[model samples]
Target: MKTETKIMASILIFIAILLAGAVFFLSGDQKTMSQGEGNQLTYKIDYSNGQKIGSDSAKIKLVEFSDFQCPACKGFEPFLKQALTDYKNDILFVYKHFPLPQHLNAKTAANMAEYAATEGKFWQMHDKLFETQEQWSALKDPTEFFIKLGKEIGLDETKSREAIEKSLYNNLISRHKDEGINLEVSATPTVFLNGVKLKLQKFSDLTQEIQKQL
Candidate 1:
């Protein structure tokens, strides 16, 4: 009788262990599903002033930290642009610079972008920069190209060049970086939506997330 009881106890312990393992597996799966449903952009983030474009008041806001020379950033540009166009009334997108030191032209490009912002042409220059990335990327005279591009886009070339020289938006750029660092951004093209790091895997993923927030 005692031997029989021991055998039953052992069986029950084994069953309990199996049940616990199953629970753990299921919990992990649920967590993955939950995370997948959220913003795919993974980066630590902090905000300052919060007065920047797209930050003040919007149904949904996306903050993108990017490098001008980053291939990934370039690749993701189209999807981002589509988001802006598709959700113009529902979403506001903000750009931040996190130019990597390895890219020789990235920092300069960032500076130029900041200067463009001062001229009230940030978005226009932003589009031109990304559209003409390949042309100016390999050249040593990227500034001239940017200047010309600005003129083509109705920006005052003389004023634009002067803005770049004077670094008019230098403080704003620095503020963006400072805020990004505080937010724990360690990479380029990190995006956040409504204060959450987007978990977006593709344009579709972003669209779904935006729909939820809206």
Candidate 2:
């Protein structure tokens, strides 16, 4: 009888320890998010262009801070493209970066895409990066992957490589990040329609909310 009680007590103790560890891990993640200066984001003011593809003076100005390696951002792309198609004359789209550290290749991918922006291939490279995210995101050397993507998009490989190597638009990327932080972006794939936060859950939610605003 005593042995049975000891066994049950041991099992309970193990479960308690497991639960405590899980709580600790989750808390650490929250702490990391709130760790920056002022414990909040501060976006620097800059009017520099960021790979503008559509009309600059559209009625709806949408700014998105996303990571190339983020799956949620990938899922949101089709919806965004469809929005452009549906509201062609009404929206001006802007892209920015908020790369999470867990996704190792996001920063380089963002920088490379910024370089591609110089050649008018930002959107193309942006789409391609999301399309091939699973391939290069985990690799130690993303050069070949980036090169292949540039070739696929018909960009000058030499220019693309040189741009990334030189950290072309590095300052612009930094400014975008700072801007996003200042705007209270705590995660990748944050979208603002006319400077108002888009409460995202599904496609219909985006269309309905945006349509109302329009």
Candidate 3:
């Protein structure tokens, strides 16, 4: 009787130890998960000031920082457009200027887009700039091309030229670029979905991320 009682007591103690360890292990895992989530960087961006093309009450806000002269940005244009079209109701897409210093014409293009905005031709000029990026990228001066594009988009040639020459939207463009720099955007076409920077290899990957947010 005494031996049996001792044996039972030992068994109970071992079981208690095991239960305590299991609880600690589970709590540790939960702590680790919480820490990982907390470590994720969420940027605070002003989407209202940028060129927006979606519903204001969208659940998902996508902000794109791009350089007009960057080929990758041009390539991503179609995919971006498609995503906006497909998720128009759920997503608010904002285009922010981040013209790389290496690209002489990129800042000018961004300035032109902002100027076009004044005349209600921003989207048209934006598309035209990206569509014909290759044609004007290598020029010593792309002002002529921009003026021509302005004409095609029904912008006053003289006003467009003055905008470029006088840097009419310089402050706005500079602000956008500065904000991109502060956000650590090292490459063209850097994208953020709901303040979380995305590493997308393809357009489909972007769609997947958007769907996940939705």
Candidate 4:
């Protein structure tokens, strides 16, 4: 009888040890997951080279990785503009190039914007590109329209054409795309607010987050 009792106690002790080990492992895994979430929330975003739309010293910085030819990006543009207007005093908005492979005119548009940047008219060109995205996106070759838009924005036709034809800003566009890739950006309108990636369901979602930061 004593022997059986000792054996039962031994079994209970073994089960307890197994349960304790599992709890320890699960707790360790939870800790690792928490750390990963913290890291993602605090990931650093680089905005040194993109087009800026607001004061650089603003407390809230909103960065967007965008493709000019993307329909969704086109849809998001108005809300983005409104955000800029609403938070004009408190936000620094930056647009970074992330032209998707499927969008034929996206890279060209990015190049044109970069050329416009050289002429100090990037924001104007940015608005023109999105405002007229449908007209140029369907064209087999949009260079002529790009030049026309450039002229509208007061950029020198010769310099703009030269920049577009020779892809003078291809390297810069590629750099921005690379930066977006490094940040795991796979879509046209990936947005980051103050270095944290935001999954925006509505315009108010963005504004609420901005208000929190402000």
Task: Output the better candidate (3/4) by lDDT.
Answer: 3
TM-score-best of 2 and 4: 4
lDDT of each: 0.71, 0.76, 0.87, 0.86
**Per-residue alpha-carbon lDDT of candidate 4 for residues 144-175, written as tens digits (9 for 90 to 100):** 99999999878889988888889888898899
Instruction: Give per-residue CA lDDT, model 1, range 83-174, as digits (tens).
Output: 77788877667778877767767766777776666667777777778878888888875778777887887777787777666756567667
What is the RMSD, in Å, between candidate 3 and the native fold over all Cα?
9.8
Instruction: Give the better candidate number (1 or 4) by lDDT.
Output: 4
- Candidate No. with top lDDT: 3
Q: What is the number of backbone collisions in each predicted candidate, taken in the order shown?
A: 10, 2, 0, 0
Looking at candidate 3, the ten consecutive residues that score lowest on lDDT are 29-38
- Candidate 2 per-residue lDDT, tens place, 35-112, comes to 334343223322244555467777777778898889988988888888878887787777778887788778889888
Q: Is candidate 1 or candidate 3 better by lDDT?
A: 3
Q: What is the TM-score of each candidate against the true structure?
A: 0.68, 0.74, 0.81, 0.80
Candidate 1 C-alpha error for residue 97, in Å: 1.9
TM-score of 3: 0.81
Question: Which regions in candidate 1 have their CA more than 4 angstroms from the true location?
Answer: 1-55
Q: Local error of candidate 2 at 81, Å?
A: 0.6
Q: Model 3, range 1-214, lDDT digits (tens) per residue?
A: 9999999999999999999999898676452233324476677778887998888789999999998899999999888888888988899999999888899999889888999999888999999999999899999888989999999989999999999888888899889888887777889899988887888978568889899888
- Report each candidate's C-alpha RMSD, comma-separated, in the order given: 7.9, 10.8, 9.8, 6.3
